[model samples]
Target: MNRRERRATAARQSGRTSPAALCQAGFAHLRSGRIAEAELCCQRALTLDEQHSDALHLLGVLCFHAQQPDAAVEWIGRAVQQAPKAEYLLSLATVLERQDRLEDAWQHYSRALSLKPDDAGLWNHIGDLLWQLGRMDEAARHLQQALKLNPHYWEAAHNCGMLLLELGRHAEAVECFDIAERLNRASAALHQMRAVCLSALNRFDEAEADYERSIALDPSLAETHNNLGLLHWRFGRLEQAFACFDRALALRPDFHAVLNNKAVVLLHLQMLDEAFAALHRSLAAAPDDAQTLFYLATLQLLTGDFERGWAAREARWRLPSVGLVDRGFSQPLWRGDRPLEGKTILLHSDEGLGDAIQFARYVPMVAALGARVILEVEPPIQQLLGGIEGVEQYIGRSSTPAFDLHCPLGTLPLAFATRLDTIPLAQGYIPAPPATRVKTWQDRLGPRDRFRVGLVWAGNPDHKNDHNRSMPLRTLAPLLDCDVQFVSLQKGVRDQDRAFLADHHDIVDLTQHLTDFSETAALISCLDLVISVDTSVAHLAGALRAPIWTLVPFNPDWRWLLERDDSPWYRSMRLFRQTTRGDWASVVDEVRVALEGQLSARRSRLVEPSPTPSAAPVPAAATA
Candidate 1:
């Protein structure tokens, strides 16, 4: 008989007509993908005969497919209890596995295996459960058993490849993926897994190809897009990276990693508002993501939201990898109102040389509270920082000075209640050494007819945003052709760019003869004006009270504050900001205008000096 007629005949012989008919009807509905009708039929069968294992198992599988794992577990468990057969036990194990109860699932799987000892599918299920429970050795054993039972078990081979990749056995993982792919060439998941293994091995080209193939096969896979985005981001392809992240978000709108990556790229682009929006969206999806929180805090600080920034910055200590500083210093930190009498305070460098230079202005403020301050500085700035008032001792890397209390240099801003207006812009804070260096610089320059301008076009190359902030010598061609006598105050002369300056007699390259910061200070003291990009020389000129016009990038460093023409920290400095992101032409043009004005004023001053006393001529006659 045909299958339908055979089922009908069986139902008639069973004598429980309604239950048998409903079971047969349920199987037909399930085969046609009419899940709701199938579930209704199964429920009717179970109502007629509560211990009907086939109806119970069908209902459980239906619920599992519908993502109702709790209901699935209940029905499937009942089916297993009523009939301890291979199919019923497998159904129960599937439900248990879905609910992440691997141990319970393993027990049910073993029972199923006992009923069909050589079933490759059952062995594969057991292997997957074992792997989920972190029993890698047992998982491998079971997977091997599955393969032996049926040598063409592609699903088992694919899973083994994934586990091998997890265990860092890349070569073995690759082999498994290869075999699985040969067995089932249409499996997108297998291709994706192989791509991940290749990526871990740093075979990016092959990994990228596999990832593309996986995407072509399964266009809705968000994870494939995210992995591709990460690959592009690592290679510095910012635009391509953002595009991949955008595609991933389109598929999975609430994906946290994709949102975070979008925020990161926006931050790189200096689109702060857009970046913050992306971060907020990410937080909405995962409110307690620590890395996202940390990044938001950094953005806050970088943008000058100090109060909120500090609150978020404090959260770093609570993260897993952050180490907390012990309060073991000799002197107590003075939080504004505290009297520092009899306290031996240590002011240590926290971040970079530029940071120390900028914040070292606070040391005197600390000392004003009657503490004997010991300034711990990096070697390069030890001499320059030593001359500032209130520092009783200069502690370099070689020094081991005793201190009662210490604080990070950056933290001094909060301690002192430093508002923008109250910043100590006292010029000549760092003193130039006595006439010796002054005379030497004056002799080197000799007699210049034009206004002498000192220039520094680049800063530390290691700075993350150096490419955007520092200008090349070629970009400085406009300024170089100007009439003023230009002197190079650049510290390190890159060899390739040196030849460009050779033919330019108007540009005086004093970089080689410069000895130290002290000598630079003296030379800057003699210049009519210092024109520079953001660098240490800019800070030096500002501190020495030299009139300086600083070229600022579009998204200037945090110290410059936002939308300001002048720095509160340097009264002698004028800022020239880029009109657009990374567009230096406008900034240079503004500098040109300011330079011409200065030169004009200098000429006017030289030609229009105060009239000398006519009576001084009589003293020359008496001497003759």
Candidate 2:
């Protein structure tokens, strides 16, 4: 052979080696997850030979992994154009899906499936896309087919479970999760889904265990922590709930839902300053979040920051949940400016039954302005609210009254110019039914030589801040030591408290005999003093001109007003506030001292002349 022939052979071999060598390097880089390096190698191969299908396909995969979906699409499309392989088609489809071009993705995915219908992973991918497009039935079918082909396909099972959960088929969802969990025991998501299904079935204990397992498997699962916090909150374990919320925040500081839940728990614990700070942090993280804004406002109001409270309260009107119907009432909400002479106004109840009872004192003030007041109230307070003077009609049952103006029961403060000092101090707003009912209660008491005291250690279980406001029956141990006869005013005694009560049998349990709020009212009339936590019973006792001492959390409700030992709404009610958040020991000790003083005074008063007898009982005054 001549030198020229040898040189031509060497040049041809060099050309072939360069492209093949570059392609092999690119494939090696791609498998090792060196995306940038892999792209460079693939690009070098493409430059060496523009028609290299292997280089183009590898480059597309690199771009996809690097999150450059658009570039991935271009490269993958060219590769598919050069050689329509199943792998190239699937890669293109995935990139298209990432770009949110779902139709193109579906077409490519279908083409890929046509090439290799037995690929269970590809089937699962198609199912996920279909689910995103609202084709749940098709998605379920595809996912089932994938599981049939490969029973160990945990991803397909998980996706199918989620779909079933969304469709409210919790039982089927649980089954799917079980199968997936069995296949992949370490899968956090499978455990999480199972927890959700169990929670839906009201199996809280099981749900909680599964959630714990999921968190253990994946410590960074922020959502699982949030869900666990919610479960604790539901069970009235505020401390545990707050801990879970804190854990979620530690995992993802900007998680707004976790922040919101943390703030809520702080509020429940009566940690107002901390709660407010948490809320502010949440707002900083996610400004313009309507739910957080609403909650912030409610807390402000409940804490006696009236100016801020009213501002926050106004936000509720803008929320989609609040509806203002066209009742043909033209008059603007009376902000205490214009005369209400001869103008018909409707006072509607808002929120809960307790809220209506507390705010009903303002109804008479509205009517006092020469307006025909129609008081719309809950059924619980219908008979009680009717007795308030100046109310022209008790429109409690229906919602069809045509009035010139309407305002929420709680919003009356904003409308009626209710200053802290001007709150109607007239006790006995809700009179004790008729003389007969009062006489009946008086008869039940028979003869009592000791000072009669009514006690309520609990409030509504569903109250957002009940964990802080409501006390355990065991915590009332100090009161049990008092010389006075303790009459139980507690309602809906929890099973936990029932066990505690059974141990202390000396205290009279009047709760079983008490039927309604009316009975509570009559009993209050007989008692010399009523001691209770912040509850409806406290309001009722206050309204009946009874001497009432209310145990308030650190951040009390707005109606209690700010920094005062006595309530403006009820002159007879003395406020005993907690000094620190969730510290009931101090408040209970203070109450014990006050009760001792009252007992000593009663002993002294017995030696003096009998008190003057009158139809109207003497108003209870606050010593504080």
lDDT of 1: 0.80
What is the C-alpha lDDT profile of model 2 across 1-624, one tens digit per residue? 345334433544676546566766666667767667567777778888898888888878887787888888999999999998898898898888878999899889989999999999889889989988898888888888898899888888888899889877898888889889898899887788799899988889999999999999998999999999999988878778988888999999999878888887777666778989998999999887766887797787666666666655656655654443433446577666678898988888766667777778888788888999998877767777777877888876466777787777877776755555456744658766787877887777767788888888988897756887898888879878889888888889899899887777666776666776766777777789999999988888787778999999887776675577998677799999998877888999999999999999988988888778778877899798
Off by over 4 Å in 2: 1-176, 183-190, 193-254, 265-275, 284-287, 314-341, 397-399, 417-428, 496-513, 554-564, 578-586, 608-624
RMSD of each: 12.2, 12.3
- Best candidate (score: TM-score): 2
Instruction: Please provide, for model 1 over 6-68, each residue's C-alpha lDDT reduced to its tens digit, 9 standing for 90 to 100.
Output: 674567468655776777777777777877767777877888888888888888888888899
Clashes of 1: 5
Candidate 2, TM-score vs. the true structure?
0.63
User: CA lDDT, every prediction?
Assistant: 0.80, 0.81
